[model samples]
Target: MLDIFRGLKSLIKISHIHIDSAVFRLHYSLTVILLIAFSLIVTTRQYVGNPIDCIHSKDLPEDVLNTYCWIHSTYTITAAYRKREGLEVPFPGVDNSKSYSETERKEYKYYQWVCFMLFLQAILFYTPRWLWKGWEGGKIHALMMDLDIGLCSEVEKKQKKKMLLDYLWENLRFHNWWAYRYYLCEVLALLNVIGQMFLMNRFFDGAFLTFGIDVLRFLESDQEDRVDPMIYVFPRMTKCTFYKYGVSGEVERHDAVCILPLNVVNEKIYVFLWFWFLFLGVLSFFTVLYRILIIFSPRTRVYLLRMRFRLVRRDAVETIVRRSKVGDWFLLYMLGENLDTVIYRDVMHELANKLASRHHHGVKGELQEA
Candidate 1:
């Protein structure tokens, strides 16, 4: 188990440079790592101890009854949740009486599938990053022109700066598709979070969507009136029925009280995930909204550039914004993120001057022609 977790530690390390927002990295990197770690921890028998254990009658084989209950799943009586734990019910869902109707019993089968489901969810969270990386195809890296390494020779730095400026001048407005793809990936991340939440709700028999909310409400409610949402959703104890043949060839029904130790880990994992997904959903939502602002408002682009690279002059930023399209600004903004602020300021100043010169020359030619 220590070796496995040590391997997982490598995944959480910052092994590569990131070209996306923190929120984006949260989805593809941190969230994926967390999900996989939880899955592995739960799947490991040493950590989880036993998946399920049941108390059986002296007549029944304990191992056989435990295995049967684990394979077939266990159930909780709904009305038992309202009863006090120490008084009417030994636990949240344990009942020895056979008087409860089948309609009142809720079967729990999610435990067996928890690890598999978590792995699947990790893949889903990473899908957007994969798509974005494929579509981006090293565009930012190629355009960076080794400027990311600021220790280059002065001659090389000058030459690289000229090349970068020339590329920007020649390719203005051409990066709309590239920028759009990244934005689309951001939107996809938000959708993926929402979709996963919905899937988890269904997977947990509709208990997950509001799991966090119920937990919060439970925390604030009077203890006497409250039913623990965690226990309700992930009961630590439940009832299972196993059947076998008697010595006389008659069928015997054995009711067993099963303890689900895995749910202890499960409840914590999901409660944290519920809050995390909600946070990511909101962050992604605002990120998309900010993207829309960047698209529709030129002043927003100028303001963002100025804010991000304070050394860049306001007029220089405005000049670039005035002369370029949203795609060009987006590319430049991304480039600014990769380049040092001082170097970026120099690049922006030179680009602004070059654009001004071009505009002047074009106007002079038109005047001469007229």
Candidate 2:
């Protein structure tokens, strides 16, 4: 048990080198850990405590009645949510109506599967990271070439810088595929969040997509106009019909009021997730747009590099941006993030000078030939 918790703890540990963006990390690490934690909490409470208790007649065995109702399922009256509590009904979704048909009863099966669903969602959230890791295969880390460490000997530093620059020059204009793979991962993250919202709506019988919006409106609406979305979605009090043999060996219907303590925990968990997913969706949408800008606009790349390192001059940044394709620029951007600021600045300066001199020599030879 201790080992299990320790493993979960490791999921949130910060990595020394980051190959992905902040939003990407949030999707794979913090969001995954939170979902798993919620799943465990719900599973533990459902099994360790009395998840359901029903008020039944003295003649019926309490344990058997409770077990039967829990396993077969409990339901809420669809019309009761519209009725005022304490006046027309004892509790929201707990009506004593003889005219209610089976169709009027909305049986909740999601409560039983909540833990498993949550765990599955955690896996979905990590899928993009898994795909990206396989495709990335430590490319950035390999190119970093220990430039992250600034205390190396001067000779070693120069040699490493030359080797890195030579590779970048050789591989110029060939990195579009690599960079596009990462952008595809970002797009997948956005799609996953949107897809999960719809999945939860289906899981909750189509009440999840607008859950956060409904809650916000409920808070701002007048008291008389307010309807608790949480109660409507996860009713605490419900009804169950149990059948048994009576004194004359005839069948009898026993209506019992069941209190679901698990729903109380479930309501809070989903409310938090509703708002959290909305936030992630908005963030991821903009992240994709930002990536598009980076791909299409070379000037944006120049500005970003200059902003990231103030010491890197505008002309040098522009020269590098003009000479390199999107893939080379992306690789240099990532290296800037991982490498020491001073080392990155020096490398960029030297690479810019070499590329500029090569361009000058090519133009001079062309003029002489003419």
Candidate 3:
């Protein structure tokens, strides 16, 4: 309890976020927080109150009622039924007319498994981000942060561009070689999404087997204003057999139904998560492509910066930056780095104007010589 309070106090002491957090990290944090909230509070509430409520005989003895509830809670009966099948003793075989259906066996723990899977999903998403942060956080991030600060502090445009060019040449090349390591993290993130699509399908129902086409089918069915049992996030009820207990150790039996309220919550949670994973999966897919283009091909680099920053002189940019000098700068910029593109745009414009002036002057000199 004291430790909990200490942790809360430390959180209160936080003034601001120093490091620029990425999109994936933010998503991972939200996922973990929601998982904790639902597991600890939402699903847990269903287990509160009575575990078993016996019915049938209004005048059933209180002792027998309590005993039945306790016994039924012991075994996990899913969905099996028997009908007054056992022999009853004439002595203390006073089998109460009341009985409860208890078909689910040991499967009572399934609701908790939902929480475990969601928690696992959140952790898996974070794994790649942590890997990238571990590699980039200490080295590339710090260096880019310093460049961002220095570039901003400079007053002269020439000095600012010079600083950027120096850093672009000196540090960016070394880091760009290892940039694929970061993309490996993106690959992991992409796999995490793809994996969840199938994982949820296997765990809950077959709807996820189509990898999102099933989700569309579910929506179309919803337009008809009908419930589709096939698309439910979790299995709600299961079948099991009730053990008829009385004097002489046994008496009667009946059909039973095991209700899981967690299934209701699971339906809502997984539906949202399924779509969420799809969105992230698509985004990660393209991010990998762009990362590849920026690293290996200079022409591709120029094209992306022209589109991304909306620069005017693509031809000049293509001439100025061959491999990844500008590509490296733009690459870090796109990955939630603190660098400002306004400075880069201004520098590119100035360079393009200079190149244009030199070309015009050379053309005029050639005409005079002729």
Candidate 4:
């Protein structure tokens, strides 16, 4: 444990963490912001708005009120009834609360579960990034930070840039095996996006599971005064019944309406979230393919490097990448498809130049000293 802390301290001292890509932005930053904002909107609206409106016998007992609140927080069956001989009997009527078919309660009390589930989904999306960071051991961030800092150095004679690149490709010097951290992150990101499509369905409506195939596309917005128990993007208007039996063989009933103010926020947020995930999923798939292709194809890597560096010949890039010991992982790390080309072209150019210089100057014998 002590050794681990010392290593962590050294890692932090070496370089700061970098977010690295758009996939990261979606999983960590955007997911968190969306979850928190939606959750808060739901919660705050309930506190300030009339979320539950119960229509029942006035001046009811305290126990009945408690029961009404409890059932109102959950899903309750709604139906119609007609009064006969002082007894309320089930009968269909447009204004009567007693004639609707049985419906299951929502899986929430006051829509708390919706936000809770969304928050859980956010956590799920974040887990891959958390795992990647754990495996990174701070090396990726350190390399980028060191390179960025050194690239801006006023000391032209300093070898800090070269030393940093050497550190990045060190295993290449000894083991001939490249560290595959970046590819692993990309693969994990792709999986996270795919898994979320399934995982979120369990928490959300069937439309999400079916990619909106199972959703009802009706505009019943004008019927706010009526009980509409159909599912939509905003499920605000629902009704339930509360029953209480007195010890003296007397029974009373309360039919109440349940509303979630957060439904408004959820309606807009989920629509956006669904499309955003789809877009991100497709992008991640291509990224996975790109990583796999570059890792296996030397010519492809050389071609990309030629485009990236603009000066290195194909043979030169290939020999330097293979002989000077740049692994698929580190090379891709610098040439990541997601990296901003303009901001990072200088760093990659420097690396290409170093490899070319090393080969041109016949410096293989001095490799140990480097």
Error of 3 at 69 (Å): 11
| Top-lDDT structure, candidate number | 2
The per-model lDDT (C-alpha) reads 0.88, 0.90, 0.52, 0.54
- lDDT per residue (tens digit) for residues 99-125 in model 2: 788788888778889999999999999
What ranking emerges by TM-score with the best candidate at the front? Answer: 1, 2, 4, 3
lDDT of 4 at 365: 57
On residues 56-131, what C-alpha lDDT tens digit does candidate 1 reach at each position?
Answer: 8788877788778888889999988888888988997777557788889999988888999999999999999999
Error of 1 at 268 (Å): 0.9
The candidate, 1 or 2, that scores higher on lDDT is 2
* lDDT, model 2: 0.90
Residue 353, model 4: lDDT of: 71
Q: For model 2, give the 10-residue run with minimal summed lDDT.
A: 1-10
**Quick one: best TM-score, which candidate?**
1
Worst 10 residues of 3 by lDDT: 89-98
Q: TM-score of each candidate?
A: 0.96, 0.95, 0.62, 0.67
Q: After superposition, how far is residue 365 of candidate 2 from its true place, in Å?
A: 1.9
Model 4 lDDT at residue 45: 58
Clash pairs (backbone) in predicted model 1: none
Candidate 4, superposed: residue stretches over 4 Å from native: 1-19, 61-110, 144-157, 165-170, 173-181, 211-233, 246-249, 311-315, 324-370
